[model samples]
Target: MSLSPLPLGGAAPSATRTPSRSAALALVFGAFVLAGCATEPPPPPAPAIPQYTSPIPASALVGRYGLAAYHRPQDATRTETQARAQCSNPYVITDGPNGGVMMYLADDTKLTEVISKQVPGQPTYIGPAEDPAGGERDRQVISFNGTVLQLKWVDPEIAKRYGIMVYVRCP
Candidate 1:
């Protein structure tokens, strides 16, 4: 006995079997869940820091000028040749603890060798005054007015003892 052919599209004994709606829905939902659970990548790092240094003025200590003894009467006058010789030496000028300039002569083989090490490329004063105590231990305060160099002691007692000296630069 021959059986009648089942309806091709019907769920009951169809000729070709198609995927059920529940199975298709489950596959699409699984693909979206995997996409949502995936991870993102991380970010990068930062940069470095710079070093500090001082910039001194080039115009502050150049030219021919004279320095006179501020305190003592005997050491008052300095000749132009002597003044030029004094200024020709290289030295560093810094601020004193008090409100004045501290001129440190660089230790050279010549006159200032007895004082401190000579700083290269430094401009020498036409005539810069010296501290009376006369050693590396000595500190003197100086003031400049383009015309003259005024040497004063920070200690009032030392100033009274040593005195201030003014040096004039020869034109």
Candidate 2:
């Protein structure tokens, strides 16, 4: 048998195949792509907060009020009378450290600072500063005259439990 010279830049003949430069580079690039994806994505942007300034000032609502709770709208008028009678053991609303009022939240015994907030074309709401107007912890102002103030909880379950709150200003 006669022997021939091998071609230059050509891999020697072998049982195992040698990877090309492009194939090796592609493997390295794929590893980099996977490594880049391993890290978590950036957090979502914060929500825009609306301006909350009530037409009815907090100072106007500060006082001792005879409080009553009723379910039906029809019962509101009657509830006012009951609320007036409860003046003996009234619900007290005091001035907060800031301009807000201090009152008890739904199902809470400790008094919390409640802000009166009104959005454009929306009913006024009362809740802690952390919550938005008409939020879960907030209560919509049903009605407020010089002597009477009515509030309904924004949360239906809480409204059902607490009922419509009627506050008749004590003399």
Candidate 3:
């Protein structure tokens, strides 16, 4: 084997020359380009949760009542799609876990506990409940007295998705 001193120092130039600054730069840039083109799917959208502006108090829930009217927006946008409205049948909340409240359909034999709002001033909120048996997620209803009288969904999207409404109403 032949030995030779490198032009810059004591080492021989490698069979594979070190890439020039521009070549290295191009390789780095190319790597970024390839990364950008990678097929990694975008993260799924977060669940849309409705915010009840005014939560009806527990005192109001302990009686037989009719759903005067209600709706779920086409989407949560400020103004996008027209809402779907319905006049619901009667339901009731006569008791609860601890002094809370329990709700049930006019004819339903099972009863669900009314969870208090985790956030102060938020209407009747439910879910993210724990079931050791791991039960299904539930939808929440927010009741309030208004010109139209609303049993509004706290999270309209979640309610529709689960096919469950936390409130008790003749369905």
Whole-model lDDT per candidate: 0.42, 0.89, 0.43
Model 1 regions lying over 4 Å from their true place: 1-58, 70-143
Backbone clashes (count) for model 1: 22
How far in Å is the alpha carbon of 125 misplaced in model 3? 1.2
Tens digit per residue, CA lDDT, model 1, 44-70: 543332111112222443334544344
Our tally of clashes for model 2 stands at 0
Clashing pairs in 2: none
Q: List candidate 3 segments past 4 Å from native.
A: 1-56, 68-89, 105-109, 120-143, 146-158, 161-171
Quick one: best lDDT, which candidate? 2
Q: Each model's RMSD to truth, in Å?
A: 18.8, 3.7, 13.1
What is the C-alpha lDDT profile of model 2 across 1-171, one tens digit per residue?
976665445556668877878899999999999999998889998876567877778899899999999998898889999999999999999999988899999889999999889878888999987678889999999888878989999999999999999999999
**TM-score of model 2 (CA atoms):** 0.74
Candidate 2 segments exceeding 4 Å error: 1-19, 37-42, 45-48
lDDT of 1: 0.42
Q: By summed lDDT, which 10 consecutive residues of candidate 1 come out lowest?
A: 49-58
